[model samples]
Target: MKITRKDFLRLSGLSFLAGGAMEAARAIAGRSSAATESQSTPVAQSVRWGMVVDLRRCQKEKGCTACTDACDAAHNVPRLADPQHQVNWIWTQPYETVFPFIQNGYAEQSDAGIPVPLLCNHCASPPCVHVCPTQATWKRADGIVMMDWHRCIGCRYCMAACPYGSRSFNWVDPRPAIAHINPDFPTRSKGVVEKCNFCEERLANGLKPSCVDACPQKALVFGNLADPNSEPRQLLRQRFAVQREPELGTGPSVYYLV
Candidate 1:
């Protein structure tokens, strides 16, 4: 339950506006939680972290769980045999179900039943943030929608607000279900709604998100969208990419190159 120096520095800066965050961090640490280290300072407009999924490369081979397994193991996501209690940070789903709008005649013309990876989009203006009465789920300086677990009351409001159905709530003690215990990150208890945070702690630690690093196919691309020279931005300029549901105008950071 050792708190990283990065988290110490982050709490030090936040001491002014929110003394509660410090106390919460202490409580989380006591629970053997991985405290999310915040940005040293407010991120400027030039830093908008985003990701790209090259669907062309994401096709799963037999017995392959490279990206999903790595992400869950790193984050301590649990596996529940109960279908109703299943929790997924990042996982593959049928293409038609993922992109329901492209249905019937539209979907049949394309990939059809192919499985596609999905996760939280970490939108530019996340509806979850707007609906959170406790402000538990809030966007960080770098275009990331992060959750303050301590502040989360487990009300599931964020889950209701998210149009993408990206959020998952804990129905039981999620810790016991974790097969691989990577102490680098903390595990969640029952009742809190959780989802992909875009691995903000890894970003602060000068590392890529576990999922991105673990991908065998190099299908996930993460970078600052504001940087025109970045790989994600460069790809966006050259290749055609589409959001999950652009009509909602959530301004999702993640794009899929189908």
Candidate 2:
């Protein structure tokens, strides 16, 4: 009689069964328990991970793809020939395009036409997780928005819910497009959604995200936002920073220092 979050998810997923998506419904039901169980454990009460990107440092070298390349190599992201089908975990976009709503006169005057690197914001209140019927995506206690590629039913609810255009769906088998498969990371099959997880696995092993480590200019700063003394927090306090679409109230963990 008490319809919990898990119950709601299962029932919602079952509705898809009426449309002949049996496997998707099963995944939604079967994973709901595990998803509910994980909700509390992985969230660190005091550690909220976040990132700060120094736009000045990042733009020192024009057309740099080191960050993107490192992420792709570490995660085994495919480099498809067709731009439309490319699986992007982290990539660059025009400055104006990145922050269309913000009226930053300083950024417009100084940093115009710069290619800003974009990735998952890992919002504190993630819309993607809420819309997912299968519980394939959820937010960790540490404030990282995570994905369970195996549990994904290709419903693309998460994709639609994400305002940043971060999630990528595998339309074709991704393995062939990867130049060199990383033995450590798993390759995704066609039909699931994938995106940056802020290097969740690497963080567990006491390492920085690949993009942060690979930046020659030391542009990307990763640390705990909850810790006031952390690099990210320190930088945020000392510099002028902005997030993408803050008006939407997603509480994006990623910030850009201009």
Candidate 3:
């Protein structure tokens, strides 16, 4: 029996997830397939934001909380302690699970705990937008997949449509779970689904995503995938990178270098 990539992601299991912010991102990515989209929009630039994760650098790191903590703090994401209801805007996964399509030697990457940071891919053709009855999740003009929390009906249809299992529902009020509240960030109420928005708010303010800023190992890179001179494009051209579940045709913007 072959343990396929989908099977690997299923086995990886996500126990925690955090709240809202991804709607704006989903709207952008949901508009087109990352590989095919022209990455055009009116209000936004001709930019397609993407990420690159270098396993070699990530391997040297031992702590997984840096990215997660920064994301939570920047976005006011809650720390749901309950295993049944924990929320994660960003988290870690084993290398084997992150790149299950690759075989044999890749397992070595998981030797010292792969702990690859995982988040919403902001796929060019995000399925989350397709299933959204209220257009809560849609692709933005700049090619980010975004979510409108006010528009979401808690249908979880987007969650089911997402092959990456990135979306998290608010089963309870998330305020009490927060250790420190960032007054600038908005909080999510119960019965809403939220995920990483690739820091749309920060981007609007001319800043990088919180996770990218906080990674001490410098394992993560963020840029406009459409720009040939962008860091992400340069890395993709020079290094061997792969996306999670490419077979699903989501055209994820996030790439991983092993």
Candidate 4:
């Protein structure tokens, strides 16, 4: 009998699966070379998100509510009756309230002094992401931390893990209070933890955050910290700054100028 090249090739191919012998051999030898060859490699995506808060430009005029209003309107956050249950994605913290020492020893006392706008710092080593049992919260490739509301089991472990108290638990449904909702943003359900996304929707659309845009004084600047050419990076380099709870080692993306 004469075997043609095609027939020979076919027989050779079948030889690998000839019997239980090959399977046992492959199992003992570890992953088959063919299986390894077929594996796909992971592709890396780049995103180095960061923020800058220019305190010098921030004015106490209107109590810095512009950023809060812009953020609430954009995200459809509800106004709650009780302070404990209240959900604030981005809120203002009075200078004296946040940093009491700044005014405690100083002879000057003024309520009109500029108050800092507080939000999720979106830390480089976010403890919230680490403590989430459901993997609902995670940091994006672009350095913005995000929450997957659907995947969230409402554990609220992230809340305790965050040192800055950036995470807010949705104690009640927020949709009822939303008179007008922005289609671009999704309203979060009750039971899940939510916080600032750095206006990730806007970022994905190639736009600055609502708070950044709403600032009359342009106090807030958002850009990539990795890029020295970026506005935030340049601003940080030019000015002395501080971050909230630096002792936690979260590597907070937001910087505050005194």
Candidate 5:
């Protein structure tokens, strides 16, 4: 006489089959109730997505390259024989050069001592979004800055607008140089600008970004900044971190641990 949760679900399924008219009426009532609840709940709008990069945990032993590899493979990023022709959608850049001002008198430091992973900062006030003449780049309601390749006129204004040097233009046909390709992520055509999308496709499906999932050391944390309960916001609240070019007032969502 005592039905467990699983047993109750099973019984409910059987009842749907047994009472056809009643089940249909219940379904309609359930839908109406759901609508009522939805209207009363006041749907949450406005999300500020952000990331936290823990430098203390990132000592290069983690082989953070896995994130780079996953992103490159997913996007079908091309490899160039010449460094000038090389294009990186998401890759590591020298920490010293990235923070040259921070270097001060340490210009000759070895690579072993300094390493930084660079990607689209996904600024709250993204300059790329502002400079795009065709409105090719935009920030989504969920706080993701995305690109519309079809609308891009290839003027490279976004590239100039970006202070982080995150945007890359396809000077040549990238498809020919792609060693491997992932069908899930679309590749950009030549004469178009592309950069990190924060794995928007994955985020849309209630999944974490590929880079966050791929990081072995768990250094990168991504979540909604608006929700204080989100992992990223909680991490930021608990940890002392720094944002790249904070004075620029771009309001970068990405944060770094020093």
Candidate 6:
């Protein structure tokens, strides 16, 4: 059997779990988990960050890539020419693909072809975090699912655990592929996983997510979902919204207002 490059990389990632490195990785994960719990406070747990995408508004501008472009620029996400190695923080999926449960005939005709932006849902119970043996991916106190690139073992367990297909593996060194690097953000090396973090770095600086900020239609709304007065919460109350695979019980924080 001829092993492809991708298969070789996958095998290498699995082989990395052997020997002294695996034990050291486990030790680091244990210590980090302990510190995370000890550092959590009431204020940190009070705010739950969420995003609401108004599909009605978003579809008005057909083929617009502003949100995705802004996200890539801000995060330094590589723009690899090959589809196999493309790295994206935010991108679009056909409406039908996003909501397979919606089988109404009229609804399908009207909305099925629309391009709905997709990203990590930042679930209340993130399977990616739970499956990461290195503690590389963990849910933050504020409900953000974070990736600690340094501790990532590239085992791809988190990728398998995420049903949304939100995670991307660094099949090669990503820096060189980036058209223009964003110095504010760090780049990833080969053998690591990456994904949208809800722009936690920007949030810490008191700014909205780059994607939300760049949406010309003002389709993306971000705020603390715990606050009833927040735009996302208010929208959820007034409009009909649905999450990606809500039945899976992951408690996705990203909602789409239909």
True lDDT of residue 99, candidate 3: 66
Give all candidates' CA lDDT scores. Answer: 0.84, 0.90, 0.84, 0.80, 0.79, 0.90
lDDT of 5 by residue, 134-246 (tens): 76898776677899989898999999999888898888888888888777777778999999888888878999888888888888888888898999888888888777787
Order the numbered candidates by lDDT, best leading.
2, 6, 1, 3, 4, 5
- Write candidate 1's Cα lDDT for 16-121 as tens digits: 6487877788876864332233423345577889999988887655345788888898888999989789888998788887777767675475687777878999
TM-score of each: 0.80, 0.83, 0.80, 0.78, 0.77, 0.84
Task: State the lDDT of candidate 3 residue by residue for 27-67, as single tens digits.
Answer: 66765465235433444456889999987897787766788
Residue 44, candidate 3: C-alpha displacement in angstroms: 13
- CA RMSD (A), model 3: 15.5
> Which regions of candidate 2 deviate over 4 angstroms?
1-44, 103-110
lDDT of 4 by residue, 34-109 (tens): 4343232224424577888877787536655888888999998888777998887778776766555456565436
Candidate 6 ranges beyond 4 A from true positions: 1-44
Better of 1 and 4 by lDDT: 1
Which of 5 and 6 is the better model by TM-score?
Answer: 6
Candidate with best TM-score:
6
lDDT tens readout by residue for model 6, 26-121: 888998798667445455366999999999999989899999999999888988878888777899989888788886767787777899899999
Kindly report which residue pairs in candidate 1 clash with one another. 34-186
The clash tally of candidate 1 reads 1
Residue-level lDDT of model 2, residues 1-258, one tens digit each, is 799999999988888666667776887797777767765444446999999999999999788999999999999999999888889999999888887766466658765678999999999778998899877898888888889989999998888999999999998999999999999999999999999999999999999999999999999999999998999999999999999989899889999996
Candidate 2 backbone collisions, by pair: 43-141
